[model samples]
Target: MEDLLRPIYQERASDRDTLGILLIEKTRPNSPLTDDFDVILLIIVEDNEDQPWHVKHYEFDDKTAALHVVTEELLMQWIDTSSYRRAVEWVIYGKVIFDRNEYISDLKEQLRSFPSVKRDLRKAIEFGKLVKSYSEAKDLYETLHFKDAYSRMINSLHYLARLAVIEKGFHPEVTVWQQVRYIDPEVYKLYEELTESNEDIEKRVQLMILAIDFVISTRARYSAKHLLDTMGEREGSWSYSELKTHPYLLSYGLDLTAIVSYLAEKNIIKTERVETKGVGVYQRKYLVTDKE
Candidate 1:
């Protein structure tokens, strides 16, 4: 692998701005680790001329390599948001072909530690997905759209599996089920029951709705810690609009309505009714309450 990438390594070895360059070889015969390429060269730079990342394909020694040029900032964003699960795997498992001041090494250590703030944020993002998908699935099921409801339930389960893994102090990998099975077997069992049941899809869907409600009810408050914590940053309550557009939540890509409604409904957060312009109407604002 070094022989194949020696050119890339030598070319940037002298560049002061180039902080780190790591190599990841495809782990399996049909691995998508390198997007089906034989190898990947992840170049971490201080800056990329205002571009977050750039990609190029090259033929090296009759094999393919995908070279990814990314800034350290954007790479950290990816890690924080779980935007690219494969990128997390790369950071954890990729080989350090070159390093300046142990940049990649320290990053791997941080990710392994799994800071509370990142965990809370990731859980919020994944939980937002879980709630929205499950709500849509419930609506579809009530309207007798069994097929579509089943599809939505699958998506909800996927999010649930991710949450389970994140709460267990690990980022959800590309193969999410593999992590969930050991971290939280009950959630994995729900996945198995929904997907591999011998019963008809409708029946499976029917059963999962009840099971899902229980799980969501239990996880709602803890899963929403990131948002709840944000709301606590100030003294006054926050309107839906304020909470949605808050800078702290800008990168979470969350479903604000679903999360806030669930939190309010559960009394995890209190509601304040402010009079609206119209005579008989009120605008609801949310306040952070005792989080015991």
Candidate 2:
């Protein structure tokens, strides 16, 4: 493997700040994400504030090499959030062509550990996104936007499937539905109802929306426990902006106000009005209730 990759590395010897190289071989035929590429080369580099790494692709004869240039910080972020599970898998299973002071080996160990905090944070974030998508679909449907509602509901189901997989302690892959089918068959069934049912479009969408609502009611609080825990960190209530800007919560693309509203409605959290000096007469603050 090293000999095969030596030429590629030597070709880019002038490129500085490279920490290591990872070579991921194609193990399965017709891989969905690989685009028939024979191998994937991931080059991990030190974060450079002056210049960002540029990605390149190359092909030789019947073989193809797809090059991905990622900074160490970005790579760690992806691992923590499980945003790029396949990439992390490659780092774990791929052959390391070279490393600067064993950095790549240490990084592989980190991926192997899969810390629980990152897992919980990732699950909470995904759950928040799923709820937000479901709410959007419901609002669109109520406004008589059937076509848009259908599209948004389908999007919600995708997030729902991902959240289900995350809840099971597995990082969802690009083929999320396939994973969800085995991990959470109920969500798969709902998806089939939406896509395969002979019912009218509106009725099918409505049925899916109902299923989403049931899921939100039953699972939202538990899935979002990480966010709720952060909200209760201080004795004072948390404002929407504060929660939205939270370091841990920001990466999930969460709808903070929507989540707070849902939690309030479910009596998991309570909202209070606090007068502010400049922003407004009063601002809504969310607080964890005893029920939480």
Q: Which candidate is the best by lDDT?
A: 1
Steric clashes per prediction: 0, 0
lDDT of prediction 2:
0.78
Question: What C-alpha lDDT, on a 0 to 100 scale, does residue 50 get in candidate 2?
Answer: 55
lDDT of 2 by residue, 158-262 (tens): 878878877777767778999998999999999999989999888988888888899878987777777877877778788788888888677664466667778
Root-mean-square deviation per candidate: 1.3, 3.3
Model 1 over residues 1-292: C-alpha lDDT tens digits? 6786888767876788899888999878898777889998888899878688998898867888988888989898899888887788888889998899988889889999999989999999998889899999999999999999999999999999999999989888988999888999999999999999999988999999999999999998899989988888889889888987888787654688888887888898999999989998999999987855
After superposing candidate 1, which stretches have Cα over 4 Å from the reference? none
Instruction: Give the clash count for model 2.
Output: 0
Position 15, candidate 1: lDDT: 87
lDDT of 1: 0.89
